[model samples]
Target: MLKYKILWFLFNLKASLASYRHEVHELGFQKGKKHLKVERIGYLPQQVNESSGLVYLAQDSTLLTHNDSGGAPYIYQIDLSGKLLNTYPISQAKNVDWEDISADEQGNLYIGDIGNNSHQRRDLCIYQVNKKIDAVLQKIPIHYPEKQTVPDAEAMFVAQGSIYVFTKNLDKSGTDLFVRKIGDNADTLQFKSHINLRTPITGAAINPQKNKFVLISYGKIYYFRIIEHQIDFSNPLYCLNFPHKQTESIAFLDENVVIITNEQGEIYRVCEN
Candidate 1:
């Protein structure tokens, strides 16, 4: 049996890298949510934490804690509208080089802790919230994926009952996206494939239907349709970007729209026309 893989469909054209601008334009020839300005729940100045990676607008609210000067992109809980409800504290804050956060429909939240510099680290793993969440219980539990042999990647996507990882592919001409199913050393995930993104992808997310995907990077947002074969890295179907600090997470609120979150906890709602 052929191991089925997910691919994104591209629909638009042209590529120009220069200056940062914020404008909404529906690329013709093809098709495509909330109107409220993401009311600032509250913010920590950029100087607070020098580094930024992933932010899981985690489904659990009580698990969310407030800021601790110890480490990381401070974890927090916010309403769908982006209001700060609570924040989670980091106890040890060890190896939390978080790249992005992905959640299964079952409410299982996967935090991508693999952030590699120079692609040198050999040991990598994903932090699985092993603690079972009960409708009656209000505390957070900690769980982790066994271990992985895949290279460190800043991008992660939850799809087809597994997880997909992609690195920045920075300074190497076009981008390259790597795929791997989620598992551990005990029950390792099979290696899927490596894709040449040809685009600078900061982060990515799979839709609820798991039919399509969206990515944000290099100050632009791109969309893809799922295909049976490997992706063709030559062109993107549709792409757009705003003047933000390179987006990190792309969560789909619906088929025609999605949410792109920046490092500083800012979010953009893209509505296709």
Candidate 2:
């Protein structure tokens, strides 16, 4: 049984017409259209960008943990069945600014609290959380920029034990990214290297097997072919029409398929065929 709110959202999102490209026009996409090979499994939804939502890929389980980016300071963790698991509060959780979470192989989680719209922040933070989810208040510590502040990043990806932050607001000065290596759980992650996109970046994705990486920006998703010694980011193997909506989250189900969910609860599966 679906909640009234979830059902209403699905009904409204699916009302939008099915088109490879959508105009500025507005339509609630109807669910019956695209042969949704994926299921509505669960939702970690935020009201617009007021909070963050997370869902595990293994099962349709959703963790209703949203950062209190406005009213409270708790990260409410819910099971995929939408059951409230636990609430971890952080005095550092900012209002309407906390973006997303990324996890490494060690079960450690990174909370990105750098969604600055004014682009004035000198230090961007990627908060670190121990693999033990129930770890307690103050169990996690946040790291911010020591010199330059990079803002408007809604995307984070884990690679080689480091957290990579991508900026949605690519400015003329050329957008740069951050690399932070995790240590002792709470110790300041060592800043490794900055990868200059030379252009603004929008989204990021790593394959399920942790073998490949893809970035979405300038209205396209480009794949990165990785070798032992070099990573080729020259071009995407194949590209699909960027969704009608400005997509935010990218989660891979396997090597050949991915489920890109829009903020409005619309999920699109990019099949590699």
Candidate 3:
């Protein structure tokens, strides 16, 4: 009987140790520690001199991008190799400072025309269009509450049925974040929070499945986790610096894969191993 009791004790001890080890592995993930690297994958077409924003279409394995204010009012379709496949023209909308493009899961694309460089534009809006066509469905007008001076922003993304804009504050203050419901009829957009990223943010993207969002500046990328519908800026989960001349756009190919583009038409792929 004593021999059987001893064997049972040994088995229970081994099980406990295994469970402890499993928990340690999970903790590492929660801390956002991982091996990752960024490499130049391709170059954009020479025509896309200022590739401002990028959105990946997983349904067809293609990318939709556009230039900034001075370019034509058209969307360029490209592949992973930066090869221009097609162009869709939005005749109804003017390309007045189109800084970012975001696509929802429901085949709708949102074009942000909210660039206020001089801080004097009272006509800030986002154009919603069909993903497969060149038709502008509707225009969502935005207003900064209690202030006539609107902030200049170049990065916007759609997630969880809401649109968010991150500012590129030149005043050296922290960046301001704004949120608006998808279909709400509010004249003034709701202010959510602020992120103290001192550098000017040029682009943003989200990895939905992993609950992670990335922000890009001139030569640096910042990662943050989304918690309770707000950006958790306690500290950046990860930060990376790469050789980018003028990085302006970012997109997620998957939870671990990221694609970035620069104003000079260079494309890079960042992967986590």
RMSD (CA, Å), each prediction: 10.0, 8.9, 16.0
The sequence of per-residue lDDT tens digits that candidate 1 reaches over residues 60-166 is 42222222112553455555455556545434334445666666666665666666644555445555553242121111121223344334466676665566766
Error of 3 at 200 (Å): 0.2
Measured against the true structure, the TM-scores of the candidates, in listed sequence, are 0.63, 0.61, 0.84
TM-score of 1: 0.63
Instruction: Point out where model 1 deviates above 4 Å.
Output: 1-74, 89-93, 130-152, 183-199, 228-236
Worst 10 residues of 3 by lDDT: 23-32
lDDT per residue for candidate 2 within 157-206, as digits (tens), equals: 77676566655544434334555554446434443334333223445667
Q: Which residue pairs does candidate 3 place in steric collision?
A: none
Local accuracy by lDDT, each model: 0.47, 0.49, 0.77
In model 3, which regions exceed 4 Å deviation? 1-34, 232-235
Tell me the lDDT of model 1 at 210: 61
> In model 2, where do residues sit more than 4 Å from their true spots?
1-92, 136-151, 172-175, 184-200, 229-235
